[model samples]
Target: MTPPPGWYPDPQAPHLERWWDGAVWTEHLRAPEVPGPPQPAGGVSGRAKAVALTSAAVVLVAAIVTGVAVLGEDDDGGGPATGALPTSVPSTDLPTPTPTRTTSEPPADPDAVPDVVVDELNGITLPLPDGWTPPKNVPEDDVVMTTDDGTYECPAGVGLCRHGLVLTRTVTENDEKSPETLAEQDIPDAADAAYDRDTLDRRLYGGIESHRTVKSGPVAVAGRAGYFVRWRVKTADGPGGYVQSLAFPSSVGSESPVIVRFVFDAGPDGPPLADMDRITKGIRSIGDADTGGGVGSSIGPTG
Candidate 1:
């Protein structure tokens, strides 16, 4: 006959007790309880009570151990059991951050000089002499300073013209050429652009009849050694004019060659010739610092 539902010795694990549910053995298990003293006068003895309490304590501890094993199997597929503390996943490798670079030089000052025109685009500054002012209609990339007298009817009877003009720009197209070669090649074009013809193919100065070199040599401008070619052109009408092409490496960016063109009516009405030298001397970096070698000191010809 099968035993009733109660603790009994396990056949598989002899050291532990298994439950018999009348029909078959169940998974519930515990330790076997030890016997106590016999009862006296139909009342429970103190030793019997003590044995019952000890057995109950042992059952409670066994139940807790079995429950913890079940929880560990459910959570981690038979891994070690853990307490109530939360667990964190392992972190992945992260990329290091890049460091930023900083400069020690102070910022440029705009009001470092009086009566100056700052060409922030070209990274240079020019002295605004008494009679010259920045032109409004010119493109922002090009720097132009014209006489205060402004435009007048061209001597060639087409469009308007200025008696005195100075323009500066970077030589982007053929900047690979040397400053001297660039200056020499640019003077003839400068003459045509200033005195010979306007953009519309109209003879602004009645067209250039002839041109002769007035000065051609090495010169210092804004502390950089450079070259200049000045030409006295005779036009078909009007009192002709002088055109000059000055080329030097910029002190600020890429050291690219910069060209400054000067066109002035040849006589009392135009700006004085000495103003050219004065303007060259006054040229400086935007911050009023001399980064180039020497300012306006003419070194003899390279030839």
Candidate 2:
């Protein structure tokens, strides 16, 4: 038998009620009842009311006497009855509290994390956050990928690249250089090429100038030493752009060491630094002992 309906529990929101128009669900929703202000005192007979008034007077008198006694004990003569109970006099002009509408804000969504992808040739893996396309095979030992629909353009004079997220992975034989040396020298040099003020300002930001290297520092990646660098380009008329770069040596001591670099660019909207940090932590070599890899202990790089 079909049940007549007015409102029923919403399948999507367990605690909320949704309107059912006897045949189908409606968009209308019914908010849960909120408690109201306390009610005024009531339900007393004339005789009881008189008795209550008498009892209240007695209590007030007793409180006043107690206060007087306390004041008498103070060595500095007598004082006002500070502890006396106040008498409640009925007033027709007194106002009742009015009810006000109130609502609670909805909860925020959970933080998103990236997906992990392994470069079969290098035995290394890194996270590819949600909304990003899977890695596509590239020439030689390189793979490339991007966020889905990750294309954006800064007006002509703002930045070099007008686009969305672009991630590239290229594994080159480690030149036996310490990660520090590689980061200290190579990252700065790369930043110079990527963010030449004249070239960028000439194209974007409407002649408004901005500097590079908002922040840079040492960071560990995939259980190995690495470096992180960030650059910002602000335009006079637009939201601006940000770039983050990271590089680490895949196999620290192998005869054929590998260097891995990951760069992220967010135009105007800015980069998700925290999400990027979490992604960096998730990076790992498929076979390194420190990172649960099959490789045993390896020698540390010498200066």
Candidate 3:
């Protein structure tokens, strides 16, 4: 194409520095005097700026698309820029604790059952009242387990007597109300009943009473609970009277303990509550024994 008139040439241009005129080259193509904005970094041409801007927009769009894909996969609205709402978390479910009970089994004949702690249930025997038959088996209920206690009885007319005691087991929840609290309810009531029968009835009314006793703290039964009591009422027969009970808390129920107790009118050979305690101290938990609670002897029964 033919150059037009008045076109100028630029000496600064690396190539094609000349401007076109209607007929031929002219030296009028001086570089423009006006200055441009600062050159791009690294002195790149202005066109490179446009290319960089387009590249940035492309990257931003790619990020948005990637985030959208991630949000679709989770469907949990975890991705930012998805404009999605979050859902509430569901509450967790937990397992509940179960309760256990124990029962008493008859002691096997030494000939039939080996004479060991397992057979004994780590049990210590007590004297049964004359002619009174010990129940075949202790009832199984909330108890952990029951042991054979021969029998228990107090003579009519009140002076001397024999008693049998059986120990049993029961499990309790860690958070449940303690056995002491439960015992406080029954213990005072039992003692009060005995007191009314002995003091008000016998001492005041019947004219055959002797004395009374004060409140005592809870006692321990080997590895069990213990409670105590006192008898002030003496018979017209002789100078003899005593009181006792066990009130220890159960290891199983950190909240409380099973209340164990024994009471009697002093006899010629007075009931063996004292000796019973001596033997009880010898008890050991079955868990510690050779048997896994099968055949071992101890004062404390393992829970």
Candidate 4:
């Protein structure tokens, strides 16, 4: 009798099993299943052993057929075997990954103010007049424009000095917010810093001898209401100079008050007093494009 379709030990390859299509061996093959413990061969003839082995093989094949039928019933009928895993199935429940982004500030335009000194902290720009340029060796945050005549021996015999100096800085330590009040309060210190004495208490401008208010009034600066206090200072040894403190609210940031201090030697060599008015008129916000005369323009004493 012919055997039913099932996996059986391959006649050509004893280590593996081949498929029998109920009549002949098919090409499919698989590893043989693990064998049971050895049966006792004592007192058994070779023929009898063969008969027993044939019967056991038939039983095993029938059991394998039953297992396959059960698996087919559990799976989608005539589809893949039960419990088989797919190669690559995408999941709908998981979130897709997103890429990260970065940002930065834009670069400043070089052509915006080609001939000015920009003070970024105070959000203002000071125009460099024909005979003036930015001073070297000054603090990074302190903005100063001075006469191109450069540094010279101080008449007071203390340190190097510039004949004309215009310095700008933000007022952070003071509690006063009024532009007029702050301007008035800053003039004395501005004079002292420029003419009276150095940080080492050494005399400057031969030590300021006497100072009288030359200009004091409400004014407009950089399109904002402001005030300035200018003084004609007398020094002990060299030509005396003028010192002025101008205060205004910043156009950018937290709108903090800003102070600009001006110092000019009192002689034929010092920067012209008219330059003071020119610089004052030229004061503007960092990015302002207006070239017209500044608001509330005022010219200082020429002599």
Query: After aligning candidate 2 to the native by TM-score, how far in Å is the CA of 95 from where it should be?
Result: 53
lDDT of 4 by residue, 1-303 (tens): 444577754443443456767655566777545344555657666876787677667655754564455444533443223343233322223355999899988898874424788888888888888888877675323547878887888887767877888888889996788988998899999898878887777785678889998778876677777888899999997898999888988888889999998889988889998777778777888778473335444533222
Residue lDDT tens for model 3, 157-244: 5432233333333324344344445445444434433323443244311233545554444434444444434334454443333433
lDDT value, residue 109 of candidate 1: 86
Backbone collisions counted per model: 1, 12, 28, 0
Q: Which stretches of candidate 2 lie over 4 Å from their true place?
A: 1-114, 135-143, 157-176, 192-210, 234-239, 252-271, 287-303
By descending lDDT, how would the candidates be arranged? Answer: 4, 1, 2, 3
Displacement of the residue 176 alpha carbon in candidate 1, Å: 2.7
For each candidate in turn, give its C-alpha RMSD to the true structure in angstroms: 23.0, 23.1, 26.8, 21.2
Clashing pairs in 1: 223-294
- In terms of TM-score, which candidate is stronger, 2 or 3? 2
**How many clashing residue pairs are found in candidate 1?**
1
Model 3 accuracy (lDDT, Cα): 0.37
lDDT (Cα, tens digit) per residue for candidate 2, span 260-298: 443444443444545556566666776552573232223
Best first by TM-score, ranked: 4, 1, 2, 3
Candidate 2 lands at a TM-score of 0.43
TM per model?
0.58, 0.43, 0.32, 0.58
Report the lDDT of model 1 for residue 290: 58
